[model samples]
Target: MKKAIFLMVLALVFLTPQLSVHADGPDQMIIINKVNNQLYYFDDGTLIRQFPVATGKEDTPTPEGAFTLANKIKNRPWYKENIPGGAANNPLGKRWLGLKVGHNRGHMYGIHGNIRESSIGKYVTNGCIRMHNNDVYWLFNQVAVGTPVIVTRFQGNVEEFAARSGYHVMTWDGEMVDEFQIGRVETLRPMKLYSYNEKGEPIAMQWVPANTRYQVYATDGKGTYTVGSNKYLLYTTPNDTKYELVPSYIKR
Candidate 1:
């Protein structure tokens, strides 16, 4: 009962939910969902802002991972295009949140404002995430260096996605995730769909059919998978007394 505050609040709010970051935990976090083409910003576990964003095309998919804000830059120069920082024609735009995806620590790719406002919400970046000029400026001011940055492509609201991904959530949920690949899970026996409490702990919601299959949203890398809207299925622990549940993953 003391583990799922994030999920319950999100279920209630449906749009924005606040999560309290524990000691040494990052109070500021940014999540970029390529599938939805949206960006969510959280401060001290509370959702502060969100905006439409543009990500990489299929051929140049954004590198998905749990990164940190390596640096913050205003009017960052577009070196490849030879456009100076603060240039009206620069593609990097008015602000930059350097997402450290590799050894380069995001000097190569990051979240930045786009020269083309119409590109927001579309799949068009070379690899970096794109936001509106003003939106990026707002985001750049909201967080400091070393903030957590998660880039994923899962299908769910922020709370469910983060909780299921094991972001300091309740229960046996394991290590935090950088990204979520689509997955298929087969239920061995009948299982009740579960919801989390205010503390982020699981509470049985309703009974689901036996031997059924579901395309889950995200896994804790332990066993539980988010199967439905704010719903979870503990596939590893079944009522049938047989342990035959097998999960498969798809490359997102």
Candidate 2:
């Protein structure tokens, strides 16, 4: 009875704060609506801001997955043939928030503004999430580097990707996705209905993989997942030559 009382007290001590936060809570979260083509910002359960956006087309669509604000560029030029000369019709407007999506296709995908406000809510661009010129400028002011930026079309659950070391980069239709990063992973590891850390530590054994059109997840807690040519690295060198050496997991 004494041991049972001690365990009960310990559970209450840890769980009390969690329950309190969930109840009278104000979530500090941001939301992106793919159907409405709008980005909504929230602080403490209240809607703070919203912005019009543009998404992908039918084919070669903008991938829907959780991402992060990798880097922010000021006064960047639009890459493609959106505009000819200077900043007149530049699709990227004045700011660029580079999003590191599951597909590590670089800044080829991000949240920026276009000169054409009429195309703000339509299916335009190769596979980028576009916003209005002024709206993006405001958003640039709101978020900082490394802020979470989930880009999805389904239910909005933001599952974070593991570290670069834990991710085994593989090309799917020429875009990158994370698999279990263990060396000698022969088969595609069965999606274990649980959550893992960047170092493959099991967090919640009851966790399930969140569904996004282009989402990623770790399969198991073993050192046998596949990467580029094998199950060790994320990307490979030219002609299946070598793998990139990523750093080991950094525990906080």
Candidate 3:
């Protein structure tokens, strides 16, 4: 639980200026789900606010990941397209909690207010997380930058659910590579490994946390390929390169 808290703290601390540098901000937490069309706010496990929300269409379902507040824009334009400034008729009612995930082109995903209160609790938007205009207005005023924004499957064992990822290391040049695939768990969280060198001698052993970053290198030229995170089977080149799991390089 301390590690989980540390990870959350790391997420909050690394989330950029939206939270850290803000002035006169309250320490609040946000929970949003497109699956349930609900938005929740809490302070230290005490529910402080709750509201109905609208979600993305089935075809354009909102992505599932951990994100943080990137920025806040009030009364902003809906998108480029000369789409008229956000106002009474605008879909982005009053606030946009820009997501920490990268957007293609100029696309943006936000926890924004919507003009269509009637559409609350239903799938209605392109891909943004939506809330009732009044509720968003309230959120806009309350949520501070750096507040943790978890956009995930909305339900299920969020803590247990693991992402499909894998990694392999080269001993000679000491290069590590990560491979990501869909619907695989062999490379899921809580990784454990033991590494040996060319003489079949144990060099090092370690455990890796999911979504954490790490790396390793061999000072000796004769390293060996050891075990790998589940799904991936490693093969070395003819040059006697070694591979093994290293704590350095696993990342979120």
**Judged by lDDT relative to the true structure, which candidate is superior, 1 or 2?**
1
Worst 10 residues of 3 by lDDT: 163-172
lDDT tens per residue, model 1, 127-192: 999989888888888788877677766665565555443343311112122234244466776667
| CA lDDT, candidate 1, residue 238 | 37
For each candidate in turn, give its C-alpha RMSD to the true structure in angstroms.
Answer: 13.7, 19.9, 15.6
Ranking by lDDT: 1, 3, 2
| Candidate 1 residue pairs in backbone clash | 2-199, 3-199, 3-200, 4-198, 4-199, 4-200, 5-198, 5-200, 19-45
Give per-residue lDDT, candidate 3, residue 225.
24
lDDT of each: 0.65, 0.48, 0.50
Q: Is candidate 1 or candidate 2 better by TM-score?
A: 1
- Minimal lDDT window, size 10, model 1: 169-178
- Which predicted model would earn the best lDDT? 1
Tell me each candidate's TM-score.
0.57, 0.47, 0.50
